[model samples]
Target: MGDSVTSRALALLGAFDGENRSLCLTELARRAGIPLATAHRLVGELHRWGALAREPGGDYVIGRRIWQLGLLAPVQSGLTQAASPFLHDLYGTTLATVHLAVRDGLEVLYVERLAGHVSVPVVSRVGSRLPMHATGVGKVLLAYAPEEVRLEVLQNLTRITAYTVTQPARLLDQLRRVRAEGYATTGEEMSLGACSVAVPVRNGETVVAALGMVVPDLRRQLPRLVSALQVAAHGISRTLAGPASVEWK
Candidate 1:
């Protein structure tokens, strides 16, 4: 099948990932599946427009302009801005690591986080992508995700830890529970010694994001953590539904 110039250009940019952040021209061409001449010409254009930059060692890296442009995306900008206060309040209240995330394709895309002074160590960061079946936020998002997205994720489940749920049927059951209970919880699913609880943040009838907290253990603070997260999620949903408002009270 023939790809359009736009699709090829996008493929070139999309070839780069968290692990493949930098590539030389030939490597970029091969990875992008574009002819070397076409890649060279298109990459030159992208470099000139600041979508990509040439490193001192001649590798191509994503440019600062791309990051600046990504920050302008409504999901990144408006949602992060609206959710900041609630995340801060949650962090202050529990001193647990608070996370805000949205579904990006079949993955949970971390958009914002507020770390507590003495919270448990977490591996996720803003802009990082985690599996949709292995995290509290991921479960919430998957519970409400489109059927095709859920199926795709179900087929490609990767176990990050021994506690991570890899069975499709089990994950589907958990997703149903997440929807029914209005929250999701995971114990050492994504990382050791880190447990998380998450609730959905809605924009009217649409579940636009997830609000979560990571703690060392859920044995003692599970109830309180869920309560606080639900409250913050409600506030965030209200803000997302109406005009921009930071009053998360």
Candidate 2:
């Protein structure tokens, strides 16, 4: 069906990226491949529906309404309900950035995060999205992700760093290793000077999310970090039925 969709509608929501937090209508339409008239109509609809906000200079930005909806999502409310106290305790006790994420489409979406006062900074926030090949949570999520998801992600791999795993066969083997080892570790794949450890949180046989911790000094902190992360993940798994029901395939 050839729907009469306007580029403006696409542009209004397409402006958000890791680098660009907000943008003007002109910028949006240009980026979305839409005309000015179409952009106006779609932008108006988005504003009325609270999907976009109008700034003082006539620019449109992602609205808080979207964030509010995310708050209601079970991954945020339900999962966080079980993960927050543990995350807080972990961060408080170890001075690290602790995070929980789930595989959403081909990316890992941060559902919850807790941080110590003085820890290594991370790019992820409660709604931030990251690729499955470059971060600790990403690796864990990808490892347990559905077969179709795994294939699709492997087909479109974008090597973000020298440490980023780009070979499909290799990644597949690593996923197997993660499953067997019950945890994952990455050294500066997402960013230099940062290393992370992650473990799966299961609901029956299906992995619904992953828990991770970031440490700046990978060489020295890894042993203790991996142990702490494994403990936290096991704690989460026990509460949520020990293993997930969704098969890897």
Candidate 3:
């Protein structure tokens, strides 16, 4: 069957991903595999409906409406709701930035974040997807990921900071430790002057997400932070496994 209007419009929105967050009209049309004129018309409708927004440079980006709609999805809403109170409690106790993330292909998708008043340099936002080899939560997710996914990520460990583990063998060792120790830690790997510790959040026997915290340093308080993260993760896991839990996938 020929493509429908809904499919064509959906294609235009799907053209924007983690890497291609902004695109010109021509680029969007090409990526969506539609005629420029069709794209122009669909783009106008999307922009009018607040599904797309124009940047100051005239490029198009995903708009707030999409985000608002995304928040209603079962996966995001279920996981975030289950983890929200625990995240806030962890932040209150540690006074550090807390993050709840899930593995999305070869990256870690931040589902929720509680920003602390601490001056640590954290670049991740609630909806941001980051590499699976640099951040603490990323390492935890990667450690638990399927072997093929891990192999692909190992091939391109693009260094974000001087401390990022670009060497596949070294990263392999870290993943092993993450699995054995039941937690993961990163030292200035994703950003300078920031360290993180994360624990896996398991639903039944499977790990569904990662719970993490970003701080100025993990030297003196690594154990404490890991303990706290694990506690919150366990709480979330319990909630997810309960009968009243919402669908996370």
Candidate 4:
């Protein structure tokens, strides 16, 4: 791409992720590889457009406009709307961190999150990008993702933790199990002491997103957690229509 200010500004937003959700002007400039002046100009425009908001501490965080814009994205909007009420109910019942995620290339994009009151504190926040093989939701989305998409994730493999599935053959088997069981579960695979169960929300035959809940302990919580996840997933699946779905036979 040519060296354009617009391109650079977009790149700056891309630099923010779950781990680095907020950044000062200097940090944003350095991360975006632009000069301070250029960063400031772009950031000012973004602020005006409501894409970035200035915090009291003076760092910039993704603003409500970005969140609203994400809602306008067809797939994300449909999936999230269909899942929100059900997710809210799940949160009320389970008191765990509930997340709705979609596959974004080789990463899992958390599109929605409802923090459950007594649930395990998860690293996931809305718009967070997490490794596909590590988290339950990511794994569930990957499991039903097209074959080429699966290959792409495997190609970008990183061993995030001892429990992260790195062996391609093993991971493939796990995906198969996820497909059969209609949900996926992991015990501290992504974060130590946190367990999660996820189910795919299919629009007809094609899986569009994954909904999950994180629990502090897994030893005695599998049955109820899995049940809630399945119910939420099914609710979202039933609400989807149009061309992006599969006719599950």
Candidate 5:
């Protein structure tokens, strides 16, 4: 079998990533491993279809249409809608840096966040992807992730800070504890002076996402934080459960 026109087009698009967001024709061809003429033809087609846009400097970037389509994705629209109220409540209750995240392969993808003016400075943002071993929400997602994904992350643990878990054996133990305790916590693992705690958000039996909060410290307030997060997570879960949600009133 040979690469089809569709595959070639997709390869050109796939050549762009979190770092290489913009590329000239030559760079696109080189990265996509296609000939210059073929790249130019496919790029023109994608540009006409609103999949790629050319900047003033003549570099191609993802177009506005892609952003519009991404918003229509169920993971973005449905989850955000169901969790918005609970996220607001959690932020009001804790006045901390609140986050909503889901697993994307071996990384954690933050979908929503709310932060108070005085909350700890965190490095994450909506749509940002972070290492699974360096974040509380990531740990929660990793703890319950598929076995293949778990092993992949364990084998590739990278140190993000002095406190980040670099040892796969230790990280395996921590994941076990997260499963046992129903939550995960990290102290300055992603960044200095930031500590976090997280719990799983469920859509029925499957864990769909993780809810978390970043604080200056968790030593004196872990218990209260965990309780509040669980409450909000429960609310979000019920919202996602739709008409079949259990009645707790």
Candidate 6:
């Protein structure tokens, strides 16, 4: 009974994600696969414990406590902090939406982001996990990932947009180029109007993260964006390799 209650509570929490940030009681119960009565009881307990909050419209959202706990994560506390300055500098130079991301199993988890003045349609947010095959940062990380992981991801190439790389052979070719050229680029793959370029961030020889930038178009400024991303990525790598790197663990 205790275990069942715990799983149900966890399921309720898991119902919220980058896309589903808020939900009413019925929606939460439906998504969580629990009875409405059970959802109500669990949600009330969670709300009292500060694990969830009710908005003015009465929809439930992840509470401040969840965010506070997320900050304690190594990737969020260390990598994000180490890369914050570099991200800001890159954003200042390119005036483009910049991202710092890490491979989280089969997905790319955005750790930090700097919004640009450019009116590009950016969908990623801090703490959001996006498909690894649809974004520039995802491509870079996937290129460096293990063979089994790559195979698993390749088996499920969900098409995000018309331009997304759904063909395994083509994506494999692109991943090879990323390894050889040391960067990745995408054209309206994840979103319709946005294009992106990314480079790997390493701690010594191991790729630990990816730094990416999004713009309206990459054809005109691909080289410049790649250069800026590489510079920022290298800086982050150096910081992670230094004595301050202990924070990352």
Clashes of each: 0, 8, 0, 1, 0, 0
Clashing residue pairs, backbone N/CA/C < 3 A, model 3: none
- Each model's TM-score? 0.84, 0.79, 0.83, 0.81, 0.86, 0.87
Candidate 3 structure quality by residue, lDDT tens digits, 66-108: 9899878976778888988899899889999899999998899
Across 1-106, the per-residue lDDT of candidate 6 in tens digits comes to 5249999999999999777999999999999899999899999999999999999999999999988998888897778888988998998898898999999999
Question: Model 5: residues >4 Å from true position, as ranges?
Answer: 116-119, 244-249
Model 5 TM-score is 0.86
Candidate 1 weakest ten by summed lDDT: 240-249
Report the C-alpha lDDT of model 1 over 68-156, residue by residue, as the tens digit.
Answer: 99988987778998898888889888888899999998889999988855668698888899888999999999999999999999998
Q: Model 1 shows how many backbone clashes? A: 0
- Clashing residue pairs for model 1: none
C-alpha lDDT of residue 98 in model 3: 90
Model 6 residue pairs with clashes: none
- Model 3 score (lDDT): 0.92
For model 3, the superposed segments whose C-alpha errors exceed 4 Å read: 1-7, 14-36, 47-65, 246-249
What's the best-to-worst order under TM-score? 6, 5, 1, 3, 4, 2
lDDT per residue for candidate 4 within 76-163, as digits (tens), equals: 6567767778888998888788889999988899889998445575878787789989899999999888889899888866776677
Cα misplacement distance, residue 169 of candidate 2 (Å): 4.3
Which 10-residue window of candidate 6 scores lowest in summed lDDT?
Answer: 240-249
Runs with alpha carbons beyond 4 Å of true place in candidate 6: 1-3, 57-59, 245-249
Q: Lowest-lDDT window of 10 residues in candidate 2?
A: 240-249
Kindly state the number of residue pairs that clash in model 6.
0
Q: Specify the highest-TM-score model's number.
A: 6
